[model samples]
Target: MSLFAAETRIVRDQAGRSVRVPANPRRVVALAPSVTEIVFALKQESRLVGATQFSDYPPEADRLPKVGSYIRLDLEKITALGPDLCIAVKDGNPVDVVSRLEMLNIPVYAVDPRSLDTVMAAILSIGDLLNAAEAASSMVADMKGRVSRIRQLASGAKERPGVFFQIGVSPIVSVGTPTFLHELIESAGGRNLAAGDTPYPRFSREQVLALAPEILIITSMARGELFQKVKEEWMGWRELPAVRNRRVHILDSDVLDRPGPRMADGLAQLFDIIHPDLAGKY
Candidate 1:
């Protein structure tokens, strides 16, 4: 490549759309914790001027002004912050709110990167938008490497377990196909019991009992009763294989539910739960 070409800058999204980014993006705001962590992972923490209420990651992120929840963004407050760039999710943030922000001339990059591969790509995309592509690539590469190691370790494992992922207890919900958590569960060498047309669909207790899941996993909610009370209640159902074998486990919502840079860690956690010797290794 010629020196002129080497020094030239080319910024385009994975979809081939050209993007123009500033040299130094100061006064940044993140709308969600998962998305917030990605911004910090790209090493743009110092430029971040504000974040939403739940955007508490990297420790330093919590120090930023509370922009409000992702679903309900305060346009007045957001406008007052005067951020150079704002990170948001396509599904999490309401369209009307985003549109209003746009009408007010605020630059909002709405991203919805699903799957582990795409998640990493989105991280790199954020870096590119922030002109920190090198830092973002490094973090994403590490996550990719970790995922590869996990798959390698689980390769020679025994027969995978038939797993039931419970998203809720009061009203039974399991990780369904198409959800990244379901993919993570499969990556950890477990077959989802709730497979069919149901994708995060409402399930009945009778349906759960009929499946006879070999392992039952519950994902904890934010600051709620996330432990044994809801999961261990299955102990009464002696007929259930999971209850009889004591294979029921509860996982942190952030670790299992959030599709962030730590999904590899979530997969590692699932692997540990499914395999005895593999525990704590990932």
Candidate 2:
């Protein structure tokens, strides 16, 4: 056994359940896009046998056998593939699927990384489990450098705008402290108006009207009728400070919401939107 392997230790998951598996597991199947990206970052594509439907990042991830979305996982298909280990999100996927996989002794594990710190820890954990600790350490260091640089640049900004992240128009939902999106807002030096009480929640117009944010950020997956609807509706909120200031901007949902390597890029884009002042520094 290698020194890294001998030193490795297993930790309880977000649900506080104790389970034991290899510190460095081969034949891994990632059940979420984020985990898929993390595995690729560790340069362990050779060990990845399967992925979820949306694991399109790193390009080649699209070429792998997709087990379907976390919410609707195909247990029989996964069992047939016989991956040595499986990794799924704590809350993104259905609990029933995890339960079923457990009954079959598929060695499926769950993790929830809602905040930035948790995200880093999750990446390192995945890397360690994959025997890619060196990669994890390097990746974490690089990510931290980018985070530090952004904060340094942001700290010097004269004006930090208040941000209103619009997930839906009719319901008028926005981000909160519990969501990673909320951290993105803070990283960009803007105050998130919505509390997001938890990771992605619904909000009402009255709640939004009270905050009166200066910037409106809408994440759009497609640019068709849906985009038009989001644009026209928010543009109609004439009383909003963002609408009044003409700071309503649309961002790519996949790049921002995927929770992968592009997290730094997402933070940079948000920084650009919330504080155009920092753009010159980069």
CA shift of 176, model 2, Å: 1.5
Output the number of the TM-score-best candidate. Answer: 1
**Model 1 regions more than 4 Å off:** 1-20, 280-282
- Stretch of 10 with least lDDT, candidate 1: 1-10
My TM-score estimates for the predictions, one after another, are 0.88, 0.86
lDDT per residue (tens digit) for residues 1-282 in model 1: 344322323355444444343445566788778878887776678877778887767788788888788888887788888876677776778779877876775567766766888778878878877778888878888998888878777777877889988887668877778788877877887888876656687789888889998998887563665466777577788898999999988887787666678787888888988876787665
lDDT of 2 by residue, 186-244 (tens): 88788777765565667676677677889888875454578666767778989989888
RMSD of 2: 3.6
**Which structure among the candidates has the greatest lDDT?**
2
The local distance difference test score of model 2 is 0.78
